[model samples]
Structures are given as structure tokens and as C-alpha cells.
Target: MLYKLNLEHILFLDIETVPQRPSFADLDENSQMLWEQKSQYQRKNEITAEDFYERAGIWAEFGKVVCISVGYFTLKDNERNFRVTSFSGEETRLLKQFKQLLQEHFNLAKHLLCAHNGKEFDFPYIARRMVINGMNLPYKLDLFGKKPWDVPHLDTMELWKFGDYKHYTSLKLLAHVLGIPSPKEDMDGSMVKDVYYNENNLDRIVSYCELDVITTAQVFLKLRNEELLGRDEIKKV
Candidate 1:
């Protein structure tokens, strides 16, 4: 199935998120109580809610998306060229730009939104954030009433599982095992919150997010036994 897939039809994406507020104290009294309750399932008895707040990005309700980087493969001089772009900044603005991209370019029946662990994280987070930001859900993301086989989304992690629900794989590890170059020279998900709130470096975050997009597209291509994008073939926009 992967071998027959049209590379240009997939919008490979990755999102970077951070806590809705810089710190737990930033939340209002009502929100603080709510967060305390929400953190119960994931936090240990000894770990306070404030201490666990750094991980808020993992949950859509407690976090806001900061960056969404996407890429697609196209032919250039008879070779695959990867073009990467990013929508980043204030949560609403970033989401709006991404929505516009979907409505205008990727709004076709054959188009799909692909990501690593997207079905469980990136896809739902974007959909929920869109609704929260007072925007309508795009056609490719609004899974309402869609049949099991009709969802126009592809998850690289899910594809790697091959129906083994018990297995889990990280994108970085998959790339390493598959001999793809590592993109984690600077920072990782654990440091995104500090980098965004403390250091105030959206550019660095954007760079990291873009690397994930390229790595995701590379991993997908490798799955199909196809040649990966060359260094000179990656274009930034």
C-alpha cells in the first residue's frame, strides 16, 4: 500500500506545543483546580500539580500549539525534492494559517494529513485547538461520522505497528534504526517549554519542528523502499 501511495498527496506534519501558560501560577483559580484534577491520572501521589505542569503540552486542553511544520515531496529534475514550510507564532494565528493551507491546497479527496503518532496527538490537538480558537474544523481533520476506513489521515507510527497494538515506537528511534540521520542536535520535546517561555526563542522551536517534518517525510519514504531526499533537495519556505 505504501509503495502505491502518491508522495505528493501526503502533507507530512509535526507540531510543537507548550503549556497554555508559562507556569502553573499563571492559571486562574478555577483553571488551577481543573488542572489539578486533570493531572491526577498522569502524576504520581508525591508529585505536585505544579511540578507536573511542564508536561501540559502533551494534553490539548492544558496547552497551546506554538509551531506546526509541514512538508511534501515533489519532482525536481527527475528527483524527489522536499519543500518544508511552517506556520508559527500566536496559537490562533498559526492555526489559522494552517487551516488556510488545508482549505486551499490539501482539500482534495486524495490528499491526506500524515504524521508520527498524529491520530493520537497531533491531529486531535489541532482539531481541538481549532475549535477552541473559534475556527471550523477543516475537511481533512474533521473525522465526524467518518467510517473506520474512510479517515483521510495517515500515522507513520501506526503504519509501523502493522496491527500490533502492543508495540510503540518513537520517530527518532525509528529513523535511527532505519539509518536516517538524526535531527536532534539542539533540543527535544522535554525542553520546548523552557525554550519557549524562558528563553523566548520561537525561531529555535520552529527549526526543531521543521526538522521533525523532514524526518517524518523521510521515514515515510523509507517505508515504501524509496530513495530519501538529498540535502540539496530540501527547500525551506
Candidate 2:
């Protein structure tokens, strides 16, 4: 299936999210109570909701997307070049900008939106976030009544699963096993919330997100038995 894919038509992407507020106390009274209720089943018995608040970023209702990094392949003279761009800063502003980019460039039958664990995390998360922000769903992202074959979203992680539903693979692990360059020489997802809230380092987060996008694209290439992109071939847009 991969060997038949048109790499240029796939828009590879990754996103970074953080809790909407820096701390649990920053949440309004009603919101704080709501979060406590939401975390009831997920948080351990010994962990209070306040102690578990840091994990809120994993939930779309309690989190906001801070960066969405994307990459695409272009073939020139039989060589492939990858160009990446990131939409960062104010959450709604970035989401709106990203939507426009998709509507303009990738809203087609041949285009796909690819990510690592996108079917479970990135894809639905982005759509739910957009709905919360009162934005119309982009054509590719919204799969309300679309048939399975009609969905344009692709997941590299799912491809690696090979029908082993009990197994899970991290992008870092898959890239490492495939001999693709690791993107986590610096901070990883665990530190994204702190980096955004405490360090005020959105540029750093964007860099990490973009690296994940690149690594994901490379992993897809490896899966397809295609040539991987060298360090020199990646150009930031």
C-alpha cells in the first residue's frame, strides 16, 4: 500500500499542545471543579485533581494546540526534497491559519493528512479543538459520515501495527528501529507543557514539532521502501 502512495500528496504533520492555563488554580471555579470531575477516573486514587492537572493537555477540552508543524515532499529531477512549515502562537489564530492552508493546498481527493497515532490523537484532537474554537471543520479533517475508504487521514503508527492491536509504538522508537534520525536530541513531548508555560519557549516547541513532522515523513518513506531524506535535504519553510 505504501509503495503505491504518492508521497507528494500526503501532508505530514505533528502538533504540540499544552494545558490552557499554567496551573490548576488559574482555572475558573467552575472549570476547576469540572476538571476535577473529568480527571476522577483517569487520576490515581492517591492523586488529587490538582496534582493531575499537568496531564490535562492530553485532553482536548482542557488543552489548546500551541503548534502545528507540517511537511510535504516535492520531487525535482528525480530527487525528493522536504519543506516544513509551522503554524504557532495564539491557538485560534494558528488553527485558523492552518485551516486556510489545508483548504487552499490540500483539500483534494488525492491529498492525505498523515501523522503518528493521528487516528487516535492528532486527527480527532485537532477536529475537536477546531469545533471548540467555533471554526468550520476542514474538508479532510472532518469525517462525520465518510466511509472508511473515503477518509484521507493516515497513521504511520497504525501502519506499523500490522494488525497487532495490543502493541503500541512511539514515533521515536519507530524512527530508531527504522534507522531514521531521532528527533528528540532535545526536549520531548513530556516537557512540552513546561516549555510552553514555564519557559515561554514556543519557538523551541515549534522546532520540536517540526522535527517530529520530518521524522514521521521519513518513517513513511522507510515503510514504503523508498529512499530516506538526508539531513541536507530538509529545508524549513
* Candidate 2 positional error at 110, Å: 0.6
Q: Can you give the lDDT of residue 10 in candidate 1?
A: 89
Model 2 C-alpha lDDT per residue in residues 1-237, reported as the tens digit of each score:
778888889999999999999999999999999999999999889999998999999999999999999999998897778999999999999999999999999999999999999999999999999999999999999898999999998999999999989888999999999998675458989899999988999999999999899999989999988888988789998
How far residue 85's Cα lies from its native spot in candidate 1, in Å, is 0.7
All candidates: CA RMSD (Å): 0.9, 1.0
Clashing pairs in 2: none
Query: Each candidate: what lDDT?
Result: 0.93, 0.93
Error of 2 at 60 (Å): 0.5
The residue pairs found clashing in candidate 1 are none
Residue 79's lDDT in candidate 2? 78
